[model samples]
Target: MKNILLGVMLLLAMASFAQPDTAKWVRAFPVTDYMVDISDSIRLVQVELPEGTSFKEKQLGLLKGIYRDAQQDTGTIGYGRCHLIKGHYYYFTINHKQSGRKPKAEDLLYTMMDSKPVYNGAITKLASHFIGLQEVGGSALYDRYQVFLAWTKTDENNVIDSIVSDINYTGSYFLQSDAAMNQQIKSGRFAGKGVLDVMMATGKDEVFKFLEYMAIKPNLYAGHEWKVAEIFATWLVSGAPAVIKE
Candidate 1:
């Protein structure tokens, strides 16, 4: 009897969460014909919530799930995130779910691009987080963050040069295992490497090019590792903490 009651309660909770108020109000990411042309590589279906509503993580249960399903029905998406634009909170999903045919961006919506993405105050916030992490004194984390922190001191010109150098360089950092990587770090194997090496270890060049793509032409990096690179960029620019998933 107790188990039955518990299961009933869980179902009720899930049902409520599955249709939260956020889902009541939503639309597409202001799609335009010009946007569709530039959006060829953009895999996510960008949806905007009603104006004047702030995005609360707890309130996104249904909203997230709704988009997750939408993504499945759309072939362009690979992942997702909630961001703000034009005084409204917008959620973008990399739409991977689809039937036999992929939808064109022009068919997704009919609107014009109104605003652009800005780095905003994220750079300063990112710096503060790195400082806090370094003071905590975890050797591996410190090594990882140090590269980003060094980025704080340089100009865009130097940073872009380094990114290009990594892209042009031929050496790839491949490791046999996590243990081997830790051993490499201990031995200073990647000492002269650039900022991206912290997250990707040996995939620095790839990460650099991806991030550069995101910075210079975000829509061009629709799928294929864009979200992970976005997460790392958010960490470096917005001070989001690192989450390593093995």
Candidate 2:
């Protein structure tokens, strides 16, 4: 009996070590269902604000949703953010040292305003809710122009509840690791080796032109729609303040 128990403990220890580290995987992607509400037709427009102005200060009308993405290189630096309010898309960027000086709120620049959407449908704003759930998985719903995510291993057998549960599982994990993602922006192994081909093919190139401008390889994983979902989840959390571009 003693020998058998010791063997069992050894096996359990080995199994624990064999388990893949899913934390990074979970952070790198989203776990949710993205469905566009067709009746929700809102024209999104890009807007510019003077230096250091708080977007929340502007009565942008109920603050529908928001998204933030940013990165930097040696010479040029960029921070981009998007706000959806009352069906209007107000997007802007903060370029560090674009004029070869210190960054100030007044130094922000607004890029070209395209009618293109930062996302295809209404965004679900879930903040720090799903950061602890394990056994997560994700996929793209290109037909809906969105990504789908759910638990890979769960006892909940009901298909409906399983679907509903994902509502709160947006890409909060991604934002939680903003520092790591930004570091990857500069020195990721997959840096700029054509990881953005699918993204570029989807008419979303302008959304990430900062990567091109800085000559850094886009560090996002393809098909998972991590970028889109990160922006999607930012809507409700009201998101982080613009950081100085590295």
Candidate 3:
């Protein structure tokens, strides 16, 4: 009986959360066609959301201050904060914005505060949650890429660079593994080519090129280069793209 009662209570809680027309704020922007052309390469998606969403002003102010300091200290893109409030749901998007291209790690950080599992789940979910809260509508391009960018003093090892190197190394290993299996099969030492080899050969170049583009043509702010880079990098590395299952 106790278990049954708890189950009923849980169902009620879920039902309440599912109620509609409860969102209060939303913001939307359009994604350019050029961005769409590279969407697959970078693993990004275009989306729409509402405008005038409620955001935590105080936090945003503090983040802006931090970004100013970061710019002065590193000359790289820093971070900014945006908030969303809907019924009882609240979150933030520490992102970068650009006029012509996608942002980079040097520009933005799409983080969610006041939510469980910080840095949890897909980047799209964070965007979607913000949109849902605003209850407004707009669209923009989103790269579904996942790459890290670390910021450290000049003398310290760059954390972001280290992470990027690690990813590339892992990718290279997979490529080599595929090559080995192929050679063995051609020599009649194995049954046939393995799936791992095929996958490595297929999307590897596209992924590498996409990362390079991000590093070079990263989206930028009107006058704040570092701010743009930080936001863009955060979005790119936050794991927004759907994982391809082997």
Candidate 4:
């Protein structure tokens, strides 16, 4: 009898959360076509959210990451952030007006605060007792965050260069497995036609490019460049697939 009562309570709770007030939670924005550079090679095009997707209330969930804003004078996005939720990856942006300040021209990235997450099941639920929150971006306007996860391959080098650049910029290379690459790199035991070979060919060029990237954005993360290089080096070696399968 006790177990039955607890189960009933759980179902009721889920039902309450699943059926949110659409009027307060949902909003729509007009779609505009443009490109946002995510890396040296990868550029993002805004994609709209589905008709009924909603954002969770701020008290219900929160997301932690940096984001991009449009330049007021130039009308271009020269600054941005990448989403590295527990594991899933995305690049997101919010409106500068809603943000209550113009994105500083010198500031290439802004860390998000009090930003609400998407109320979607695709996100991983945490111990906070609320549903999971997914991060997204497209428009800077409210309720207009378009999902940014879809991918279509254009060129292998483009994919490789982009992911390598993203990994460096977001410091997400730290999240990837080294696959025992450190030892191989140190011992110079790379076998041809494999990860090591790829690294050998393009590693130097990528490093030089990353240095240039850092020169341009000095406010980027500090003290993690070496690790970033190590992580993305392996990614470059591995062909830098758009979706990193876990």
Q: Each model's C-alpha lDDT? A: 0.29, 0.24, 0.27, 0.29
lDDT of 2 by residue, 99-185 (tens): 232222212221211121222111111111111111135543222111112222122223223322332332234335442332222
Worst 10 residues of 2 by lDDT: 122-131
Question: Considering only N, C-alpha and C atoms within 3 Å, which residue pairs clash in candidate 2?
Answer: 32-149, 44-89, 45-89, 51-105, 51-106, 52-105, 66-235, 192-217
**Prediction RMSDs, each to the true structure:** 18.9, 22.5, 19.8, 18.1
Candidate 4, residues 104-193, lDDT tens digits: the string is 222222121122343422111110121111111111111112321221233223433543444443333222455344323322233334
lDDT of predicted model 4:
0.29
Error of 2 at 161 (Å): 16
lDDT of 1 at 104: 37
Error of 1 at 214 (Å): 3.2
Model 2, residue 230: C-alpha shift (Å):
21
Candidate 1 local Cα displacement, residue 144, angstroms: 26
For all candidates, what are the clash counts? 9, 8, 44, 1
- Per-residue alpha-carbon lDDT of model 1 for 130-238, expressed as tens digits? 1111111122222212332233334434443443333223222222233242222222333433324444442444444434333332222221122233244333433
Candidate 2 ranges beyond 4 A from true positions: 1-76, 80-88, 96-218, 222-246
Per-candidate TM-score against the hidden true structure: 0.22, 0.18, 0.20, 0.20
TM-score of 4: 0.20
